[model samples]
Target: MNKNCAIVTGSKESAPYTLIVQTTWIYPGWFAGLMKQHAKVTTLLKFIETANPAHVLLEINSEKAPGDFDFVGIPNSNDRIAEGYAKTAKSLAKLITKKIK
Candidate 1:
């Protein structure tokens, strides 16, 4: 079995149901532009094309409200970063629950 499958199954066996969640760069503006400046677009496209129905490529973006916990920025304090991580954990939990069901 593959490393991913072994990690999921805790044995030398494939997972019965695999949900591959790949978190890529933040999208839709400046960060994406920066990424394009560094990486080849063709290579990025080819990498994206590797995903199938079972794969989820999550392109996170900044929150609309700057004060929100999920806002993408260098937080003023560790508490802010912790809050953002908590929000992300909750979101991922919901996503995984939905996918598994």
Candidate 2:
């Protein structure tokens, strides 16, 4: 697995370690590239264990970029695909510290 890692800090509060992982997954055209190819419950958990991230900000592109869709508290499985991603994001937050940074 090829992993890309970076430590980013903004202001005093938004400094944390960020990891950019490239895997094999596709969604919409706009945000398809941003999806974590290796993003799985186990994978994310392992990352948290290894990185010990203070605040994990999963971005489709870069830490400064925003997501393609507006996330609202993890979408219903049947509601939308993006919702599921958001849900995964939320769930991952519990195991790891995550926020906009």
Candidate 3:
């Protein structure tokens, strides 16, 4: 696994197993080569490609973000962080759990 970022996949809610990938985003070209290697490398049971879908992050050919985290910060453009939509929405939907006999 490439050492740049962390990838945690699989759902504890429904999925049967855990498949965490500790690597940065994968490029498509690199992935294409990987698929080639898969043809030669196989196991008694099955091959990796047939088993799992490749998780790839397509690289964009564009200018990089000036600052960290926020994208709209050119010369640190005094921008505010976006509120967590799911957290905020769930917070709104929180009802009292008090159960009367």
Candidate 4:
């Protein structure tokens, strides 16, 4: 029961906080690694920590980075996944905020 996939945002306005989306059961660390690999995504983690996540998401599933946030092949995606995602996303937000300072 490993739910590694997570879609997170710094905002709490609505369900789709930012442009970030985790459609699969992947880890946030791996997502950060991919973000590091992308040359086009400047201020990548910063943007994720701030606002407007849609811009970086444009390059998410592309060759520059390979990932799908469509949430497929995941059984009972709404169970333990939500809690795990929350924890992971919260940790990432804290790390990003710390790095920005």
Candidate 5:
């Protein structure tokens, strides 16, 4: 596990349960082309590395250990994109409620 995951897991000693929410990249819609162009520019400038959606999915899946703590992946939520933040929050709340119950 990574440093962040280690810290979260360690918290299990203090809290009865821990919920880890891993958010994926932004939602790709009509702005796909624009986003791609921006990614290219950022990559060339070394500001950010290109992201692999598949890798992210795999990581989220692998980190899941219901016995240790609850984990959920909220896609299209990497950044607080105004268009989808509400939806993401609702989904997250539902997951958390389900876990707690």
Candidate 6:
């Protein structure tokens, strides 16, 4: 299994205001690429619709929020690597960050 490290930080929840750190794994790629796929997006949206949280914090490698995790370190077949997959993951991460706030 390919493993991409994701660090979740900042969670301060009150009765009225809730803060959460949601650490989700994106196998073989970052979060955005995972969501861009039609099937994957559908699945993710379904999960979001079901588990509606107050706030969320996501950690992914991006220019805005550079992550310490390395996608190449994951144990995945070379053939599965897509072009600009990392950016996609970053984009997804951004979306999650927005939803949290």
Point to the candidate with the largest TM-score: 4
Q: Which of the two candidates, 1 or 3, achieves a greater lDDT against the reference?
A: 1
The list of candidate 4 runs beyond 4 A from truth reads: 1-17, 26-77
Compared with the true structure, model 5 gives a TM-score of 0.26
lDDT of 2 by residue, 1-101 (tens): 01111332233434244443433333422223334222121123223222455545443421111123443322322234443344455444433343433
lDDT for every model? 0.32, 0.33, 0.22, 0.35, 0.28, 0.33
Give the 10-residue window scoring lowest on summed lDDT in candidate 6. Answer: 37-46
Error of 5 at 2 (Å): 29
- In model 2, residue pairs whose N, Cα or C atoms come closer than 3 Å (at least 3 residues apart or on different chains), thus clashing, are 23-37
Q: Is candidate 2 or candidate 4 better by lDDT?
A: 4
Query: What is the full ranking by TM-score, best candidate first?
Result: 4, 1, 2, 5, 6, 3
Number of the top-ranking candidate, with lDDT as the measure = 4
- TM-score attained by model 4: 0.32
Which residue ranges in model 2 land beyond 4 Å of their true spot?
A: 1-14, 21-23, 27-79, 97-101
Q: Residue-wise lDDT of candidate 1 within 48-93, one digit each (tens)?
A: 2232533534533323211123334332344443444344444445
Over 4-83, each residue of candidate 3 has an lDDT whose tens digit, in order, gives 12333334545433233222222111113223110111111111232343533222221111112323221212221111
TM-score on alpha carbons, each prediction? 0.29, 0.27, 0.15, 0.32, 0.26, 0.23
* Residue 96 displacement in candidate 4 (angstroms): 1.6
lDDT of candidate 6 over 1-101, digit per residue (tens) = 01222425233342333332233333333345333221111112212111345333322332222222345332332223322244345565566666666
Q: lDDT score, residue 88, model 5?
A: 38
User: For candidate 4, lDDT tens digit of each residue in 20-53?
Assistant: 4444333322224223211111112212422555
**Alpha-carbon lDDT of model 1:** 0.32
Clashes (candidate 3): 0
